[model samples]
Target: MRILKKILIVLVIIIAIPLIVALFVQKDYAVEREIVINQPNEEVFDYVKYLKNQDNYSKWAMMDPDMKKTYKGTDGTVGFVSAWDSDNEEVGKGEQEIVKIDEGRRIDFELRFYEPFESTEPAYMTTEEVSNDQTRVAWGFSGHMDYPMNLMFLFMDFEEMIGDDLQTGLENLKSELEE
Candidate 1:
């Protein structure tokens, strides 16, 4: 009976440690990447405002070329939604809706992911004039995990993972716009 009690205590402590650690771990994560595109701010904003254009520059959009895509409302305007489905685990299934637009400056999107995992996050892109023909484009994404799930942040480098994809997309965007 004493041995059984000690075994139970050891197991409880092992599990409790993680839970205790989770309480202090951050729940929210945000990542941003930027690039310089050889295009005017208006021109860059115009292209990014249209979510459909992402197919040409977004790394995830190009992940599965055959992924099914659907759209709603008018592109480049508020309330437009671009949804994609793919058999690839990395691509999974998700819908991104244009929540707001700041004319030639920025566009905000709400991303709802369904398959693989469920999450609703916010993403945005901003264009600023660097020179008469140069535009600085910034892409950002932020999400929050609940409770113990936030503990994953300790082990997972969400910033690096998501930032890499954002940087790749921005680099692709720069190439597409420059060409």
Candidate 2:
């Protein structure tokens, strides 16, 4: 009986210590990936401006290939919104609004997820002319996870999960833009 009590206490401490440590450890999770496309900046930027074009470039990373999408307001302009719902947890349910557009340079948006968690984050894509015929496209997302989520990240690899997806999405985008 004494041995059993000792073992239980040791197991509880092993689990509880990590949870306590995680609560104090605050870190921001970010992923960035860039792809060089064999196309001009204007050509690539124009394609990404529209929510409809997301279907073409996003197939590789989409949580749900058949997820329902609806566009609100203008299609390619700032203030345009894209909302989606999917059974896949990776994609979840979210709406993105075009927060800013700099012609062929950058597009910034706000992403809000309904399921999984009720939170919003900033997401954006940028394009720069590497040369006359090639353009560099970069996509990145940054968000903060508090308390238990920060601890969850200790076991979960945010980069491995999301970074590869970003790379795949960029490759798909490159293919579409070059085509």
Candidate 3:
């Protein structure tokens, strides 16, 4: 039985090591990406303030074209919510609510994901004028994972993964706005 005891001890140590390490690891992650759009800042902000427009540029929104979507309240204002449901695991189910808007500057959204996994995250878009006819658009997403789950951050590059998607969406947005 000493062999069995030693094996159990080894397993416990293996698990405990990660748990201990996770105690010191960061529990939050944030990613931001930006692109230059050949549109006025006001025009870019006006378009981005409407969550409905995301379907035109968001990579995630285009993942499942058949996904069911529903909206509540007005499209471009605070308290507006856009919900989506899809059978695809990656797309899953989620709702994005416009929480705040800074006129022709920034728009903030609260994203709630319910299926496949559950988390409430914050996302935002900002528009700054580069010139009279050009705007710099920045998109950002941030979230947190508690304790042991945060350990996954060690193995996963959420920054690169999410940043790529954000960059793609921004590029798409640039193309849409410029066209």
Candidate 4:
């Protein structure tokens, strides 16, 4: 009985300490990745400004190849929306609305997720002219995780989970643009 009690106490301390530490740890989580495309800024911006282009890019990083997506409003203009549903948890479900656009410079959006939990966040992609035949594209997402999600960050590294996807998607974009 005494040995069992000792084991139980040890187990509790092992699990409880991490959770307690995580609760007190406050940090901002963010991931940013950039890729240089051989295409001009206007050309790259044109590819990203439309919902249809997202559908085409989804083939690379949307996780579920078969996820169904629907678009609303004009394809290349502000107020456009792209919603998606997927059985794959990695892909889950979400919608992105183009809230702002700056010609060939940047695109800002609102991202809402439905599965795993329901939340909305801001996301953006910006492009800068590197030269006449090259452009630099940067994609970024920023948001706060509420409560349990904040706790989950203790076990899961958001940067690891999402950063590679950003890199992969950008690499694919680079290839597509170069071709």
- Cα lDDT tens digits for candidate 3, 27-134: 999999999898889889889999999999999999999999999999999999999999999999989999999999999999999998999999999999999999
Q: How many clashes in each structure?
A: 0, 0, 0, 0
Residue 172 error, candidate 2, Å: 0.4
**Candidate order, lDDT descending:** 1, 3, 2, 4
User: TM-score, each model?
Assistant: 0.99, 0.87, 0.98, 0.84
Model 4 stretches with alpha carbons more than 4 Å out:
1-19, 58-62
**Tens-digit lDDT track of model 4 for 94-177:** 888999999899899898999867878887899999999899999887778754347777778888777777778788778777
How far out, in Å, is residue 172 in model 1?
0.3
Off by over 4 Å in 2: 1-16, 59-62
Model 1 stretches with alpha carbons more than 4 Å out: none
lDDT of 2 at 148: 66
Over the stretch 29-127, how does candidate 2's per-residue lDDT look in tens digits?
Answer: 888999999988888888887867877777433657778788899988989999988888877788989999988999998988898678898888999
Q: How well does candidate 3 match the true structure in TM-score terms?
A: 0.98
Whole-model lDDT for model 3 versus the true structure? 0.96
Span of ten consecutive residues with least summed lDDT in model 4: 54-63
Q: Report RMSD for candidate 4.
A: 2.8
- Mind giving the per-residue lDDT tens digits that candidate 1 earns over 1-179? 99999999999999999999999999999999999999889889989999999999999999999999999999999999999999999999999999999899889999999998999999999999999999999999999999999999988999999999999999999999999
Our tally of clashes for model 1 stands at 0
